[model samples]
Structure formats: C-alpha cells, structure tokens
Target: VGRYLVQLPRGALSAHDDALRRAGIRVRRGGAVLGAGGKASLGPLSPARRKPPSSSPRLDAITLQEQLERALRERQARPTGICPVREALHGALLEELAGTIARDEPRRGTLLRRVAGEARMTIDAYRTVYEKSLLFGASKLSEAAALKGNLEGRIAELQAETASLADEVRSLTDLCESLEHRAQRAEAQAEAETHDASALRAEGEQLQGLLDALRPG
Candidate 1:
C-alpha cells in the first residue's frame, strides 16, 4: 500500500506528466516537488533568498530533478516587468542556484540557463531602481551634513558675539565707577565752600561790635 501511495502522482508536477496522465499514461515518481526558488513546503528554496557567497547545497538525483522542474515552471511564468524592482534583483541572486544545480543536474543545463536568464533580466531592472535609491539617499545625507556644519558655524559666531558683549559690559562698569567718584568729589568740594562762607560772616559781625563800643566811649 505504501509503495503504491509513493508511486501515485506526487501531485501535479510537470507538463509532460500532465500530458501523460491525459493520454492514460500513469506514472508516479518519488522525490521533492519542483517550483521556483522558494517554499520549502514545495521543497524549492524561495526564489528570493540570501545565501552566503560560494555556498551551494549538495544535490542528490531527486533534489536536482525537483530543482530543474521548478526552474522550468518559473521560466514559463516569468513576468514582463518584475515590479518593485528589488524583488526582481533578489530573483537574480537566487538564480545563482542554477549554477549549483547544474553541477549535479548537468543533464538539464539548458533549462537552468533559461531560468537564470529570466532572473537576470528581472535583476537588471531592479538594479536600476536600487542605484537610483542609493543616489537619492546620498544626496539627502550630504544636505544634512551641510546643515550641521552651518549650525556649528552659527554657534561659534554667537559665542564670539557674546564674549564681545561681555567685554563691553565690563568697560561700561568701569566708566560708571569713575563717574561716581567724580560725583563724590564734587559734593565734598561744595560742603567745604559753605563752611568758608559762614566763617567769613562771623568775622565781619565781630568787627562791627568793636566799632560800636569805640563810638560809645
């Protein structure tokens, strides 16, 4: 029963199998199902994946066959223009798996190449968008840096101006002290003049009394 189940259609896989089934050709092959470079559920790595450079997983016959089948499916479904562009570029990266796949599945190099080509175009389109985004970001960063420099310059100017104002304040304080000293001297001089005038009046009054006494004698 297990053997029969294993031999049953592994679930709609290939066009050839579909044609065969239509023609009453019943065959069931055991292995991973193939689709684009994604979905471990389908047993194909996500078509858009980040793998270490120079990293390729070892492939067995079953695995290679499944990978090839997936590439074929993805090729047929290639879009006219991969939208958002970034995902397209990612597809290109995953397409490198074709090279790894060919090492083990050399029998299907032609199919792998087709998959790689489609991924390449998608990636190329994405690269254009990626490059534009980088340029725009760099321009914005430059503007921010320039603004920062200007702010620093303004701060320096304000600090220098503040120092100059402080110096002016000190000078004004000294001038005020000098003016107060001069005012104190003027007040002292005025008091001395008043005392001298009173002394002169007293001396004149004593002289008048002496004159009257001499007249009476």
Candidate 2:
C-alpha cells in the first residue's frame, strides 16, 4: 500500500487523499494512515504501533460480526478498478477486520500469548546460530587468504634463489672451459719438447761414432 501510494502520480494521489479523507482516514507524512478514532491502519508499508492488547470492548461480538459481514458484502459489490474510491473501500474493510480482532481477542488471549512467546524464542535461536556461522566463515576466509599470501612470498624467494644459483653455475662452467684449453696447450708443448730432446741425444751418439771412426786406434 505504501509502495502504491509512493508510485502514484501526484494527481492520482491527491484524488486518493480526498477519498481517504471522506472515509475518515487521514494520509499522513511518512506513509502513515490513521483511521477513525486515531487507530493506525495495519499494513506491510505502515509502521505498526506497539501497544498491549486491550480488554475486550463492551460491544457484542454478534453485532460487531454482523457489521463486519455487511462491510465485506458492500466491498465485494463494488466494481474492481484502480481508483480512489476502491482504495477507500479497501482501507475501510481493513479497519473492520482489525476492529473484529481487537474485540474478539480477549477470549483467546492466553493461548495467543503463549504461541507468540514460543515464536519469539525460536526466532532468537535461529538468529544466534546464523550470526555464529557467519563469523566462523569470515574467520576461515581470512586465514585462507593469509596462508595464500605466505605461500606466494615463499615461492617468489625460491625463484630468486634459483636464478642466482644458475648464474653461479654459468660462471664456473666458463672458468672450467678456459682451464681445459690451457691444459691442452701445455700437453702439446710437453710432447714437442720430448721429441726435440730425443733427436739431440741421437745426434750426440752419432757424432761420437764418427769421431771414433776418424781416429787411428
């Protein structure tokens, strides 16, 4: 009903206001609708006033019930359409229903109170469970996020260390290659020196034989 009023065009709402006024309901600011005798109209869009249940009214249940039936019959007789008159009739019907309930509730008040108390307790229990679950889930999510960050940091450190080790390995490999080339050259020079020494020794022996052959002995 509040949404209906809010969405209504200004012109249409004005018309509704007039109809509601004729029906003894005043449309107040903030979507409050006060019916005759200062009773607040009950609706999803209306804020309900908190009041203790009253003692049953002096009115006879049968008489009030007849009036309620008559009002319902009158409302059903009207043509259905989106109009101020229809809205007025609907509000009047609701007032009749509320009046009937208020007048009749005393007879069943005890049972109603007990049921209401049980319902409140049930709602509170569910709310507590839901809040605990939500907190637990949030805590677990925070922990998981922290763990993921730590693992990522560790992985980054390992990758940097691996790169450094690879650089050292390359340096050692280059040094080893240079030393191998030097060793090969040394081996070649040693072989040439050996050949030269062998040739000189042979020549010395041959010259000694030539001198002996040339000497008269």
Candidate 3:
C-alpha cells in the first residue's frame, strides 16, 4: 500500500477530503503523518509552466536606425562633387559602409549605440551629394544626346548629297551612251554616202569611154 501527502488551499481542503473519503482513501486534514512502509509522494494539481531563455538578445530597431543615420551623416560631411558618376560612387560607398556597420563584430546593440548618430548625419549628407551628382549626370547626358542628334543630321545631309551625286553620275552615263549610239549611226550614214560617190564616179568613166569610141579615136 502507498501513502501520500497533499497540500491544498484552505478553501479547497474540505472538498478534497470529501473526495478522498468517497474514493476509500484515508483522509487527514493539515499536518498529516505517514505510516511506516507506506510510500509517499507530493504534487499533481497545478499547470506546467515555462520561461524564455535569458541568454537570447533582443533586437532594437530604433537604435539600429539611429546608427545607420549617423554613419550616413559622416559620409555626407565628407567633401564630394556633383557629377552623376561621382554620385553613383558615393551611393555605392554609403551602401558598403551600411553593410559593414550591419556586419560589425560587436553586439548589434553596442555597435549601434557607438555609431548610430554619426551614421544618420552621414546618410543625409550623402543623399544631397548623390542627388546633385545625378542632376549633373543628367545634364551631361542631355548634352551628349544633342550632340549625337547633330551628328546624325550631318550624316543624313551627307548621305543625301551622295545620293544626288550618284543620280548625276547615272544621268551622265545615260547621256554618254546616247551620244555613242548617235556617233555610230552618223558613221554608218557617212560610209553609205562615200560608196554612192564611188559608184557615180565609175559610171561617169564608163560614159566617157563610150563617147571616145563614138568620136572615132
């Protein structure tokens, strides 16, 4: 047989004793004694509980943002020019700096506390510099576009001139061909006239021979 001791809230003690009696278990109210050879145990009426581990770190978004802002501010304080390419370089630099800050060796909170203010200021400064640089780059690109357009217009004009020249050459070639054909026709006409003249001369000589024979010489 097993023996057990149970502790209960004063209000629940009477109810517990009644239930134990109904179950044929011996009931003793406060300060009960256990008999020899009776095994005893305690506890089973409360809900199980758990607590979160104390070692885990908490994330602080505000501190991290502040740190980033400070780093950006420092970068902004550095002298920079307003060119598109330069602005792009500055943006890249800021991004790299942000990444380094995010991957700092110390705890995130400690690193943030150390650098947050400066990073914020640097970010603002970099923003202005980058914007200006972008504007300058856009202007330069616009100028380059205009220059390209002008060059294209000139090329088009040259092409048109070349086409005109080609057309003139074609016309000249046609005229030359016509002139050669006319020259050939003229030469053929001249040869025919010369043959007729030779035939007329032979006939005149034959007539003269007949006249001489008639004149009895």
Sorted on lDDT, best first, the list reads 2, 1, 3
Candidate 1 lDDT over 1-217, as tens digits, reads 1122223454555556555556654443343332233212322444233222332334434565576557556655444544444354445544655655665687575587886678677878787898898899999999999999999999999999999999999999999999999999999998999988899888889898889888955
Question: Whole-model lDDT, candidate 2?
Answer: 0.64
| Clash number by candidate, in order | 7, 0, 18
Q: How do the predictions measure up, each by TM-score?
A: 0.41, 0.43, 0.43
lDDT (0 to 1) per candidate: 0.63, 0.64, 0.61
Q: Give stretches of model 2 more than 4 Å off.
A: 1-127
Model 3: weakest 10-residue lDDT segment is 44-53
Candidate 3 residue lDDT tens string, 168-216: 9999999999999999999999999999999999999999999998996
Q: Pick the candidate with the highest lDDT.
A: 2
**What is the Cα-based TM-score of model 3?**
0.43
Query: What tens digits encode model 2's per-residue C-alpha lDDT throughout 22-126?
Result: 776555444545565455465443333322233443444565567656765766644542334454554554444454454558545555555556765786687
